[model samples]
Target: MELTVSPAPHIHDNLTVSKCMYNVIIALLPAFAVSLYFFGIGALIVTLSSILSCVIVEYLIQKYLLKEKPSIGNGSAILTGLLLAFNLPSNLPIWIVVIGSIVAIGIAKMSFGGLGNNLFNPALAGRVFLLISFPTQMTQWPRPIVSRWNYTDTETGATLLSKLKEEGSQWIEQIDIANLWIGNQGGSLGEVGAIALLIGFAYLLYRKIISWHIPVSILLTVFLFSFVLACGQETGNMQNIPMWQYAFDFALIQLLSGGLLLGAIYMATDYVTSPMTSKGMIIYGIGIGILTVVIRQWGGYPEGVSFAILIMNAFTPLINNYIKPKRFGNHRS
Candidate 1:
């Protein structure tokens, strides 16, 4: 009888890419619902347009360019679309959202071999591209829902950073932390509501779609760093620093403002782009937190989470290399 050999058995994990992406989309629903509630139908319009555009583009690209069966069914494209939309302003034109989706799916994702192969987060890259390409539109924040909407008028309102940059420490004293937390303040549509983002985060945690290491570390790092900064200003013998009255103002402004929550919980934890090891995740989170604070405090941008996340994404490989988990009974040479 001839010897018979067979290929090794293939093991499958229960968590498919589609399942992971779908869970993420489901997790984002609370934030989306809250955004629609606060920002009107405009947010919904941008989100839907982005999702449709991304899925269609992905299908076409896979069919024609790659000559492979389309993976849009996997829900990665939809996730990218939602993330790109979330990064945008509610008042941005539909055409801008289309362009953002094209950049995200076509250039950032497909060009790099799609999904798991891309080095940088496609949504962040697209957002950054739009920021550079359309500074006026990207930076021109809409007034909170309380303000009347006028389609023709694109009057500029100050972001938290813009206010700080223009008015210094005095500007923060005038802000309402409650409004900021509850999504009644002026910022990007999805980023406005801290409560909504946290609710979504809790859902993700409950579902186990993401581990708690990255989000918790990033938030803690930012909180601790900002706290120390506030304390230093209060009693560190720096005569030039603002009065102690402004310390809590500074910390709260840093905590409950801009894209910090969204980026910390959602973007930074991207499964493929982030590291695999727990230690690496912690390091990545701390790196992003420190960079975010540094950029917000001293860099030109008022909000720094996007840049911080992208920068940390670039270092994921190095982090993984150094922070590998030890194998069972393995000894280091």
Candidate 2:
């Protein structure tokens, strides 16, 4: 074979879109397994139905509607399906999962020109849509393990965020940190557990699938803000806590509980929806963290990670516009 000489150095990445998607799927498996172990058949049904519905919708839209090569085999739709299910209650009806799948893949994704061109994170958008449309069903959190086998009739209860918002620091006195960390509380299928989300986060970090900018900034900002609010007596966020230890404990609980871990680690770091540069990513992360705390503390909802991420997603374009990446071969200023 004759050699065709070009540049002095040659480097092969060998990483394709499919490879990246599969890596993300692997990272997400820990959370999926945790949900399955906690919710049993309900988790299985919701996940499978959502995945199938998303794949089917994407297939039909690409093959018949969009008249493009079917990209369902790339696993984006399946990932979206899994993520949307993760954000929802395990006891939700199958029809609702289907609707969420449609909204995620069809509206939030394809409507904005698919995959790399979408505006918001499709799964988060679908989740917010469901939460708004079906408030009661969306907030119905089934107690974990206790309702492992049960689906619709599972024993349901409120999340830590709800307790913190309504009953204040009383949630700390009632529920210990161990239960919250290990995810024994009631909430969405995947969002309930901190351990599982951490595992996935570690895997993603190991595989270089995601960077630490967005997640770390978001988590740190949340900690600092909550610490200030807890220690400060302006609006009395953490009342009845005289000691500093108790105040820090409440802030820790707020960090580990709810969808903060899930959204910060996975949803907010979405490749197409998030900012490009490191500075932009930090700004975006800070915005999400602040918005999340604001919504949880004073906004109408107790859990605000989804809404926070979506709102930040809308600002991504502006962030990119101002904080742009350095040019390849151009020197200016």
Candidate 3:
């Protein structure tokens, strides 16, 4: 008797790369809506301009350089565009935003062997490049509710971090935390509103697009560190500065001020740029948190989430190598 065996069953999930990216875009919608509500037409204009530039650049690079049809339909390019725009100041020149898109799609994403192979987050890399190239323009955040289309003489609003940097604790007392939460304060377009970011984060959690490990770890680390530092300051050991009546001000400064929420939730969690293992994610989150606090507290730049995330992205390969997942039913060697 001859017996024939069939091929083993292969399990496949319905999830596609495009779907994952689209989910991220959907998660970002609440933040986008909030930003538009606060910043008006300028925010929308900047976001659309960045998206258009990114798509056009990706198409050109794929068609001419890679000799393939552009995969703009995959949704990664749009995500990158949205993120790049979010990181930028709303009043940034249109041409500069276009340049940033080119850097993100062409140089950072396409040049590194395209989507899955890039070592760094393309939008972040592009933002860093722009920050270095145009320090004044990049840091000159526009006042909320101002129109980008029509140049108007509005007050040059300082971000929370800048206020701290320029005037230290004296300035901190004057800032309204409610305004910070509502995006009435000055900062990057998408990072301005803490409530909006948390809303987006909730959607991502509900959709199961990302795990809680990285974001929670990062936020906790920042909070704990800031608390410890604030305690030291209260005791007159850290900075010899007078303690504020409210001790939790530093924590609020950390949470509601800059790009920490945005970076921790979205940028630091990039699948291709972050570590694969759970332990690796925790460690990565901790490192980013520490670096961010260090930079914000002592380094030259007031905001450090972008630089911190990029630095952590560089170490992801090393993290994955050492923190390999254990095999099922395998005994320890």
lDDT of 3 by residue, 1-333 (tens): 998777854556776889889998998888898778766767887899999999999998899889997899999999999999899887778999999999999888899989999999999999999999999888887777664343223345778887877675556567788888887877788888888888889988888788998998999999888877766653323244445434477777788889999999989999999999999999999999999999999999999999999999999999999998997688895
Which should have the higher lDDT, number 2 or number 3? 2
Task: Please give, for residues 1-333, the per-residue lDDT of candidate 2 as tens digits.
Answer: 898888853666876677777888888888888888888999999989988999999999999989999988888888898888889899999999899989999999999899999999999999999999999999998888999998888899888899889887655666678877777777887786788889889998998888999999999999889888877633344356565767678778878889899899988999999999999999999999999999999999999899999999999999999998787687884
Inter-residue clash pairs, candidate 2: none
* Clashing pairs for predicted structure model 3, backbone only: none
- Tens digits of per-residue lDDT for model 1 on 213-272? 999888888887876776664343435555555675676678778888888888899998
Off by over 4 Å in 3: 1-11, 146-154, 234-245, 331-333
Off by over 4 Å in 2: 1-12, 233-242, 328-333
How high a TM-score does candidate 1 get? 0.90
Full-model lDDT, candidate 3: 0.85
Q: Itemize residue pairs with steric clashes in candidate 1.
A: none
Best-first order by TM-score: 2, 3, 1
Which of 1 and 2 is ahead in TM-score?
2
Model 3 deviation from the true structure expressed as Cα RMSD, one decimal place:
3.5
